[model samples]
Target chain A: MSVDLDLIHRYRRSTLTRDELVKVELELQRSPAWRSALNDTVDAHRLGATWAAVEGSLDAPTPSRLERAATRLGAPQHLTRIMGATPNLRRAWMVSAVVLLLFGLAVSNGERETATIALFLSIAPLVPVFGVGLVYGPGADPAHEMATVTPMGGLRLVVLRTLMALLTSLVVVGIAAVLVEERSILIAAWLLPAVALSAATLAVSSFVPIRNAAAGVAAGWLTLVVIWARIADDGVAAFRLPGQLVAAVALAVSVAVIAARRDAFSRAVSTT
Target chain B: MRTEADDRALLARVSRGDRAAFDELYRAHAGWLTARLERRCGDPDLVDLAVQDTFVAVWKSAKKFRSQGDVGAWLWGIAIRRLIDQMRKRRPTPVEANVLFDQVASAEDELFVGGLHGELGESLRSLDPDLARVLVATAVDGLTTREAGQLLGIPQGTVKTRLLRARREARDELARLEGDSR
Candidate 1:
């Protein structure tokens, strides 16, 4: 347990080669008793002056828990930061998404008919659809005008925010559905349609302003569901196999259109 | 725990305002830096203040570290001077002369006091305490005349006079040792 005073002296003078320094550090790590002896040979502490000098610098703000979790899940820090800034994560959108699902669950209570649940599922996606279209849609970010000027490409920034909004909406909706009722079978029915409609909104934004695209897609979905339900004399008609087929087709079309026009989403504030 | 980065990488990150990196560097070096400071200055509180000031200085000026020297030595240089500054500002309780001599007897500072065997150790041990301190502060600790004065709370003129006498005494003792050997 002898301390290497000679080596320590050389170390204090910073005379050790990098290789030698690394070796000593590795050795220090492997042996606690040796580490303690070295500390005995080296350390002491002070309080007030450090408090004065550091002055809260060490208390720098940490990333939000969600952002940190995302990073730990292997997302890069820069991407996580962009995701955290999505406008749709605000309390209003989060609360609305949860509340809308709850409202639908309450309406579907004990009823034997599948009508109300289908109608509710169709409408529940409205919030998320809005979120996806607007989170990255021109006016969502105040700095949208400077979109072209940023080091990050507008499309990449848009995709990250859109993903943030989409993921958050789907998660809250799914949780609310599971927690409130055993209607998961019925609730699962709307899952694909919700994603499809959201993608359609992104795709449509390429041809028109973000606000117009968002409003148009929302209005179009609502009109189709309402008319189809009325014609069938059943609120559940719009969410049946036929409706799911239409939603799937729309989703595929949206993907194709977005892929085709992907190069120009940069000016999506004015044109999709 | 994950394998730690070396001091250079840690310091580079610290200089970039990386708090986590600064934290890692602090954990690695603070213990010994504090121990070394505590040994030189007996006041726990003063030693604590010196250590704090040393790190705060490090955090602010980590970028000044050119790749020229080892991080540990550069840190010690900052720490020792910080302790001296604390000592200058507030006169701490003194280590009893016996306590000071005991450290030498214990061979604790193997590089400095332990090296003082035979003629030098005895000569210093027998010399007047004031003369011995001034001599060690200048010659052993390598402080300048003004720095030794500040550390000992003595005037520079007094430190010079005592250093002169201490040197003559040690020289004479060394000469005697040589004569005896012959």
Candidate 2:
């Protein structure tokens, strides 16, 4: 079976119209052998063959696997576009509402123990802001149809959201810090770590699928807040960790997460 | 085996002994899978392995598929697990090599034998690392122009223009090398 290399090249160069592309694709697909060859090349690429290797391998290849694989890997989705566009606003809203409630409750209780309940309450606003960042974070899988063929760089989006989240968190945390006005090493330690954790959460969440990460993050944040609330009320400084341990983990994790963001974003863009 | 009740229906048949149905399901979803896996594993090879592993796992555990739920969602969950597993495996074992591989290789070695020596090597040596990177990503990596653009944060058209220029240069260089050899 012969493929029109000239046609393919022209199409790649954007000289072909949509109708012509469809026609070319149809023509190529019509020749079962050519279709099989194309499928094998794509498959080989998937299996870790660089194009040069695939080109080399094509000279003496078996044909059977390609036939079966081609049919197995070509079905198109109808709703992919629609689903990709609509953000999961409902989930975002739910998370925001819950966080706001937690923040309000912590502030209104007026309970002063050895651990400052109001102090912990001050950090609560960071939750929803961080949640937005996490959901739209460096590599988040927005549950929209635009997940497919998104022309924008995921890393660019991540950087934008991360800056927004950090800026928002810093401002709100600053307000909380001022309102309390009783600065201590303990509060300093808690605030910095918490802010960093918020960034870490965004990075980590991007490594997984979007909905799963969102649900997991929501649950995890709630649990942390509840635990903090309990500890704060009991006058226990449960937020504190050994300074060295915290520093080491933070440094190492920050590096790994930054590296993984590229990988995660690439994966999201490819599969979406 | 795949009598299109829904994607869910195809998945159910895949749970059965229906290879054809499974093939149908895979065909329907592989593009999306490729896109997602591409994000995690920048190397296309690793992406394919992760995807294949995902389908293989799905085939083995079809009985575990929950019929009342979203099939694509379940498959995607499995895909993420498979991808992470590959990542865990690919994580550098932290070898003690202070010098990278290229630094250790000698120019006189058989590795640079034949016409690949001299100008081709010199030309490559002369390229800026960023230009070399762009060239490798587009020419060698098989990423679409759009993907290459996104990765490099350039416009798709710019990626195309750059790639065309790179290819032309490579072609001219190769031709010159052959002419000189003759």
**Residues A24-76, model 2: lDDT tens digits:** 33343234333333333334334433323323433333434423343356522
What TM-score number comes out for model 2? 0.31
lDDT of 1: 0.66
**Residue-pair clashes, model 1:** 17
Please write out the lDDT profile of model 1 over residues A70-91, one tens digit for every residue. Answer: 9999999987776665454366
lDDT at A15 for candidate 2?
Answer: 46
lDDT of 1 by residue, B104-132 (tens): 32232233323333443555655755676
TM-score, chain B, predicted structure 1: 0.70
Best by the TM-score measure:
1
lDDT per prediction? 0.66, 0.49
Name the weakest run of 10 consecutive residues (lDDT summed) in model 2 chain B: B93-102
Once model 2 is optimally superposed onto the true structure by TM-score, how far is the C-alpha of residue A14 displaced, in angstroms? 46
Q: Each prediction's DockQ?
A: 0.09, 0.02
